[model samples]
Target: MVVGGDAAKEYVAGFAAGVATVIVGHPFDTIKVKLQTHNTKTQVKEYKNAIHCTSQILRSEGVKGLYRGASSSFIGMAFESSLIFGIYSQAKQLLQGETESIKPQLQVIIPSAAFGGALISFILCPAELVKCRMQVQGRDSANSNYVRYAGPLDCALNTMKSEGVKGIFRGGFTTLLRESIGNATFFSTYEMSRHYMHLQLNSNSSARSQQSKILSDVGIGIISGGLAGMAFWTAVLPLDVAKTLIQTAPDPNSSRDPFRTLGSIYSRVGLKGCYAGLGPTLARAFPANAVAIVTWEGAAKLLGVKRD
Candidate 1:
């Protein structure tokens, strides 16, 4: 059975699941982003791999360092995921017939997912700004005059104290671009994968009758979500690179325009630099999205949502 409701329940469940995923996953996420956006020219490459980076952060900064910006990450993820899932679910229902059979054209699902992706970027920008700051603070402190933020609250308070509320949302436009485009690709990819999986299962002569569909959905969801995550990072690599630059770029008092800073990055690194963080981003996306799909499906079932 698939879940049914107006937008409210979908949003709430998405928010809850997103929050849970962030709390469990943000530490790795932070590390991943930091590695992805690391300034090799300036910052010394400390750890060899992701595991090494994690251990180094923990050793130097303590466990808290691993969980830096966890609070803001949760808040940002809650809003972003809630909005994305809500819009996706509602859009899916609107686009397709309420039938058990998979739809033939995967293209029909893309617009709905794209719309959801665009909408959630608004909710995600500020929190993502803070998250980027926290992730890069260790490196920032090494070269810049910026005082290190202890955690999400510290980052927020400092930004508000110095730059006001606007400071907190500085890179919202870039975030919107990244999330919206990324999610459109993500959802479209996921739906297509799911459809393909369903088709394969249906064609199998010895497929189990009672559990085949359920297993297929679960398998498809996992693969699709992971693929979507991969597609998202690949498509939005430049935006993410720009976002990191804007977030970590020194304040105006330091006499650097954020735009110019980003331009400098582009000039120096070119396309390759823009994709600096793809490796870890891809690593984290698979399990994180797998968990998200499982949770969403489980919740829908628990709530008696009738699946077609």
Candidate 2:
């Protein structure tokens, strides 16, 4: 019997990971969103690059500008992470069957992770829609097109009222593609990295103290998690750019298909346009996901959750 833990505890572990992700990643995410949607509602680009965007936000709106939509992100991430981790763990278990001690095959890992990512899209689309909309509403007095909402709740309600429920989920398709592909890459990379790291560590465990072993586990988690995050964004950042465009378009009726949106962006600004926020995104991906996985593993251990 898998006596240490069950599937439900995965949700609790996931919730901790989600909170950690937002705290470390939200600022970078804000900058990424801003850079991606810089010209959405205006004729001129407000930011030349991530550095310029960050400096401008600090100058004009202070640090708060970078956290505009974090409220929604918190709620979204908490629920999103819980569902994703829980679903992925459950799926992986079912797929692995009685081979609990064996390494997970790529076939099982990718499909199980992708399934979790796909389902989370329904939740992520709306949460990100609100987050993007809020992030783009800058304090630039020159840009008169900004639609300022009182808060995330206001943004959600207004979107619901104006565009119906579909408005809240404006970038559903793009989000689905991004999440599914990104998560498959994420879990696979993490698993592979951790597997190798564990092999290296186990060979030396007899020579190390218990405290040293704990520290080594944390170090491994950070490296594996950071690598997983970078891999995820590298694979699906173009889709994320399209999703931002769709979500933050001034016109709610803009094309929602990610491919169509990408084509339009490519025609206008070439490849750079398709990867507008790559810098900040990659920068944020490492530490944010590092913390997330560490927190997740810690929480799982605390909750007595079992893992193969």
Question: Which stretches of model 1 miss by more than 4 angstroms?
Answer: 1-6, 40-52, 95-108, 139-144, 205-213, 253-263
Predict model 2's lDDT versus the native. Answer: 0.87
Q: For model 2, how does the per-residue alpha-carbon lDDT over 1-308 read when each residue is reduced to its tens digit? A: 12325777888899989999999999999999988887433336778778998999899889998898999999899999999988988888778777755454788889999999999999988999899989988765365565788888998999999899878889898899899999999999999899989988888665888788889989999999999999999999989999998888778877988898888888877787888899999999999999999998989889887665
Give TM per candidate.
0.84, 0.95
TM-score of 2: 0.95
* Regions of candidate 2 where Cα sits further than 4 Å from its true position: 1-5, 39-45, 140-142
lDDT of 1 by residue, 157-254 (tens): 88888888777777777777777678778777776776777678778856576686677668877787778677777788767777776766566343
Against the true structure, candidate 1 has what lDDT?
0.70
Worst 10 residues of 2 by lDDT: 1-10
